[model samples]
Target: MTGEGIKECELIEWHIKEGDVVAEFDRICEVQSDKAAVEITSRYAGTVRRLCHEPGAMVQVGEALLEVEVADEPEEEEDAAAASALGPMPPVQQLAPAEQAVKREQAGLAATLASPAVRRVAREHGVDLASVQGTGPSGRIYKEDVLRLVEAASEEVPGPSLQHKLPEQRAEQLSRPAPSAAGLPAAAEDVIIPLRGYARTMVRSMTAAGAVPHFHYCDELDAGPLLAARALLASDPALGGARLTFLPFVLKALTVALAEFPVLNSSLSADGKALLQHAAHNIGVAMATPTGLVVPNVKAVQGRSVAGVAAELARLQAAAAAGRLGPEDLAGGTLTVSNIGAIGGTYASPLVNPPEVAIVALGRVREVVRPAPGGGFMTASVLAASWGADHRVVDGATLARFSNVWKALLEEPRRLLLHLR
Candidate 1:
């Protein structure tokens, strides 16, 4: 079970069955919440005695999911074996050529027990789970098992025309209309799916945000320098594969600007007479997850370098994608940045997350023709940036100055190097 915010979740699938032995921390099932699929691990070493809910059941938090007959503590040697089995098997590259083939054959023979999440991954990658070996307890197929197979498949070259169809053929096949479901009733008419979990929480949060007295400010920035800086950092091997992106640079610039104009980062008191300025720059990056829109912030961005910010952003993105984010990850955000450009949006007036005075939206970086300083029109990459702030705490003039500072830093990215921690 997760935190109190998530009221209920769907029991997507069970990894262990009644009478199956499970070690402490071994995954027993996977539940789909509004945010993502979560694996429920066993807290006690035991044998599953009863399953309280079947697959697809909407179960409440703190409700009994199942009953386990607790097992006695295991000896050191036995515990070591259990721990070893919990990890994923070695990669295909580690095995001998002949040994790999043998293992693949053995995998085909083994019964495949996969949770719904694992099955979804296999379907998305067009991989057959029946051919994947389960490294989990009772020979269960985990999400990692399917992912490994997908990765290996990607590395292999296409065989011939027989393996892949021509574009014309593919287009023709896809153009065909889907089969009609004339005999079945409409699904919406049959089932009333109430808003719960992530969807429900989003409604509440957005409604609160809407109630705030907010103002919008829009501007455009020359993004050529920011793009070049990202390319340089991404190519540096000394950074150890740390991939730099525009969002991190934006975060860095925002932190610096926040320091100069503390009012833009401050929150208005409930009484509306006082403003509370935060000491830490906990900037939240708005992310669209499979479950819902979640803004998980990296704490204390003012203390981190651009490289460090990139690493933290990567970590938060991965956790959000996997639906493994905890309560702490979703809390304490002082300001937010929404990178709408990743999805092709040109500009947007984003709403400010409540309790936070402001939120910024970064649009796509695209080439625009503009008058050159000393000559005719010139083409340059530009990003459309928009800001939304609580009118009670941040006035239009304050937001403009803050936005200018951010824009200047991005235009002359070299200045960021001087401010790096």
Candidate 2:
């Protein structure tokens, strides 16, 4: 029986007692769905022998939820021959009683031995894992085994080429229950979880953000002077040739502007009654990673100079890219910024990082021509910005003012430099 949508995604839940007797096709468990939970029906009628999961727990799809004792019937000659004719002789040979026991162990090992990446590689390559010899510690079939087999096969066939498949499309070839170094129980099925790390946070944040009426303010800003200033600074030999980004400038302006609009940097209480305001401007920058999303914050952005902000951002970026950031780096953000432009996106309505009232997303800056006073065309870089605000904490007028200030500071790049104290 398959339990649907039990925990996150890829986990199933058993709803019945372990030893409860069940009829064929009877509903025994529920599974997770992309939309909702679905019930799983038993395939065979029998006395319930075992239950693999508890309530509120997650188990992989296709994992045996419960075992059953079925009445045995003597096999007929025709039935045996039909069974033999269905599968290849080698697969059928594995059905022998002793071989069945070995197959169970192999399946268990295959479940545990390979890492997520190794499994993907094996699957894409069409390698039969059971045939590959284990070379990992404790007889585990590691990725090397797959590559070794591929190499051997390539050597055996002398030709212009050996047709091959990617590791993910290939069938699994490894056995089961290869013990990990930490000796935790091995995952026996392919259960995926959507509730891990940033994905988990995104779910919670989206719910909260959606609950509060959100008002967005969008604007296009001219950044000709900002780009010129960046070029001048980058070319200067005294500045150590560190590249300048729009983020530090934006961060500087926003921190200063936050003083005038303090509510935008505040959080709503869990009870949803009181507004929790803080004096510190700990700005969180959203970073996307292969595992999931993580937002690491820079403490006390209010008084930091442009150089100071740049240096701190560089450190945070390195730590995030290397996955070395601690739990503390993720906490205590009063406001947030997400840059979609880096990934080639323009103007996305970003969800507010709760309990913060507002979040900003920076879009790509590109060259655009505007009519000059003398009827000649002039080229300037255009940058798009979107601000998602909690209506409970701030209104449309405030959001527009914030965007206006951000645009003004970036356009007059020298004014931004002069205003930095």
Name the candidate that leads on lDDT: 1
Encode model 1's per-residue lDDT on 96-200: one tens digit a residue.
Answer: 445654665687644345544456556655666667877654455666777787667656855422123344445665696775867775453123355654666
Clashing pairs in 1: none
* Runs with alpha carbons beyond 4 Å of true place in candidate 2: 1-195, 235-242, 418-421
lDDT, model 2, position 252: 82
lDDT of 1: 0.76
Cα lDDT of model 2 by residue, 36-67, tens digit:
23466666666665553455444433333444
Instruction: Pick out the ten consecutive residues of candidate 2 with the lowest summed lDDT.
Output: 82-91
- Sliding window of 10 residues with minimal summed lDDT for model 1: 83-92
In order, candidate lDDTs are 0.76, 0.66
